[model samples]
Target: MDQEQIPGGPEGTGRRRFLALATGTATAAGLGSVAGCASGGDGTSGATLKGKGAGKGSTPEPGPGGFDVKAENARPGNADWRVTKAGPARAIEGFADRVSVLPGESFGLHVSTTAPRFTVSAYRMGWYGGARARLVWRSEALPGVRQPEPAVESGTRMVRTRWPRTATVDTKGWPEGCYLLRLDAQGGEGQRFVPVTVRSAAAAGRTVMVNAVATWQAYNRWGGYGSYDGPSGGYASRSLSVTFDRPYDYDDGAGLFLVYEAPLIALAERLGIPLAYATTTDVARERRLLEGAAAVLSPGHDEYWSPEQRAHVTAARDAGSNIAILGANCCFRRIRLEPSELGPDRTVVCYKSSYEQDPGFKRGHPATVDFRSAPGADPESSLLGVIYDGYPVDAPYVVTNPGHWLFEGTGVKAGDGFAHLVGVEYDKVSTGFPTPRPIEILAHSPVVCEGRPSHQDTAYYTVPSGAGVFATGTMRWVEALDATGDGRSGANHGLDARAGALTTRVTENLLRAFAAGPAGKTHPAQDNVNAVYGGS
Candidate 1:
């Protein structure tokens, strides 16, 4: 039920049906910030970077927590940190002023509540035996106030709050990983989530995992407005810009992490892979964060992107870092980041197809349109290999090349099917787009989207620079990682252990190979496009 940025909608309207389906357990989780009573972890310490630019390399020396991914998860994890009771929205909710912080930095968590008081617990996401997170910090009870209602900017229809800082979170001893902060209201009135990423300053020699912050805020409707729809009762009145100054109204304010990204993070951590964390915002402004990184991993449902980020990632790929796009419909929309009341890159600006009216565009800036559209005219397929085809689909994924290294251990034969794995939204290898050469089509699945017959595809391609790029072509790929027979979790979308087994093995093969170094040199792709789509 993830809400996407609809292409042809109007000014402002209520949420589509999918946004209303965000009522189940979070399914998975990621990231955290600010801790009290924290004593150990690994990351650059004390060198707080507030709006710092382009300084990409190793972080400050580790403080109390020494830098060791294996040692950090070796500690006993606290399963009690998961939110057991998420009450009404007014019960308790909050937002971190910064999307990410270096270890030992301080950031404000602006919270609102109908309860008189609330407590906060910070959980660093990882693999600890069966426990997926560790309770690294907890704050003493703090007074709570229902902050002022969010204000909508008149011209841009942007939503933001003027809330005072409810608490100053200190990350003196936090580990550099993904974290989720739980807001527990007094007297059991309500509980909510606020997520933060303790990003790695330097991701050299590790696989850099990117959090899709832009896409998360693009779908946020806290003030009853977003890039997709607005309160004016139509998409035509949609906000031209959305600010991170307000709380997220989706998934109980945890944003999109639990369903879309957390499972992947958990699996990666479980593998004990050398991993670095950053949001798309971090990648956008930093020029060399990916330098010497063995690989870059973009998680599920990433759509909105800044041009600077694309340039950085392209540069990284050119430098031989393997690229793994773990979802479909990624890098579809072009967006610009501006500062908000709090700081830089806090505002996500996009006019969709209504780009001509954007103030930035009128000033001779790149228009905030689809990346493939005329205003910019740079199609994402040149980067992603698979082009986003359509949405609102549910079809079994049919393996077309089970012999590929990605499916090495799966033992599936060609024509094997995983029910409902290609869903909601999908991508396909299209010759019509600006496609890279020697791309291999791995899976081909038929679907009828909005009554239009078409096929979805999974693809992998290798460039001469020895960089290998793999795309999943399905948004449900991450969510299916945790699928069980009962289909109890909202993330699974009814996919069973069959789908889980397939994705897990393939992903394991994918990541381990990519992490070893330039994947094209180690496991170069074999082109098979002609065999899959003859004469097309």
Candidate 2:
């Protein structure tokens, strides 16, 4: 079920978003429950599941035997689940009133369609033995009507919808995982996707999956406006703020998920390790998030991050929770999460180069700028162990340290290169910023960005808290995981099966080790800064 798209043009590839607002205020708003959203008791006692960490979810089931993620994914999958017919942009489409929800909670569905009837199929994304997703819940055919067109706020240029709530989904017996609620019109007229995360409240000893919700909305151009360009396609007319209140455009209305996230989710779930889920928004507003988690997985293209989330994730890292950044330019943009018409933290505000006009900045709040920029001066390298460098590149990913534990199963010698594994955007270990010490360089790929020669570096470092952090330095890492064929937008950059095998093996290695607890205690990073940089 998909609708209006940001028409393909000179800047339609979505890569332009990476370069857009490369330089970038919003204020933190109080958290509140969406009007129609309410939790379904803990699923154990039906005791109202009240008090504390509302909507974050209850404690995750004990162990592999408890929730049985392996068994849950073993259920028969729907092969005809993809949104194959995106007939017209306005044929059928909708958005969830909430980004995520705890099991048993009910959330409103706001839909707009030219078709008279449409059905909602909730598909939890996982391996499903390569079926990729399992149909969890399906709704009876619901009546539809065209919602009012969204309007951009005069001052902020934010586009928001006032669509009426069409249906209320009750997640009583649903399993927690990343979900794509497919809206399908009757008679196969059209189809579009609306993503939602059934988040884990407590991730004490499981690998926590984090969906980059804010980044998804930041790049969403549903109403002909985004962080990159507005209706006129001028950078100056771009929205300073984007809201989750509206549905996304591009890739059948799935935003960046299928491209930068779904493949990785499939691989992770394929490993069948104990898993929990949360979005970046949950990390920012939830209490004690990731404190006792085994590991945290940040997906490809996770760029916009709120300061509150940075503090929370950094605290988790310092408390012995391993962190894996599988994307370039993660936590690079400082943002403010504010309340929307439906609920709290649904609006992401990033003033970009026009931060001076952001009221939050004037009030001494965190400016919505680059994490490494002024008024903050906190380089992402301080946490990511790599600084974001150049972009728009396609080069071979050269193995610099094939002996590293993360690459243990991937048989490759030093200098063995995987063509096109480093591209679009990249990061590098640089001493010029606030970087951690004892960081090891694993892959060093030479690339030409905008006709400038530079290099991409994959790195790892360990903090004294016994937590180990590894960064992939390239956004293509996730895309390559599914390189044998399926690319959501055909954005796999020609990476072949070899590259796919290489990424999968290393990812498996990383997840298995990190899930056991603090990885620094078992496999500490070997420093090679001098060897890689030649003493600078």
- Across 139-199, the per-residue lDDT of candidate 2 in tens digits comes to 5466667778888899999998877676666666567888898999988789999998888
Give the distance in Å from residue 45's predicted Cα in candidate 1 to where it truly belongs: 24
Measured with C-alpha atoms, the lDDT of residue 424 in candidate 1 is 79
Residue 305, model 1: lDDT of 95
Q: How close is candidate 2 to the true structure, as a TM-score?
A: 0.89
Residue 500, model 1: Cα distance from true site in angstroms: 0.7
- The models' CA-based lDDT, in order, is 0.80, 0.79
Q: Write the per-residue lDDT of candidate 1 for residues 1-536, one digit (tens) a residue.
A: 11111111012234363452223111112123222211111211111112111122222234321346666666667667677778875788888889998887877778888998777777788777658887766655666677777788899999878776666665665678898988899999988889999998898889898999999998887888888877765788778899888877877778888888888998888887788999999999999988988899999879999999999999999999999999988998899999987889999999987888898999988889889999669999999998999877889999999888899989899999998899878999998999988898989999899899999999999998899999999988998887868554554677889999999999999889998889899778887888888865
The residue ranges of model 1 lying beyond 4 angstroms of the native Cα positions read: 1-17, 20-67, 486-491
lDDT for predicted candidate 2 compared with the true structure? 0.79
Worst 10 residues of 2 by lDDT: 42-51
Error of 2 at 326 (Å): 0.3
After best superposition, candidate 1 residue 463: deviation in angstroms?
A: 0.8
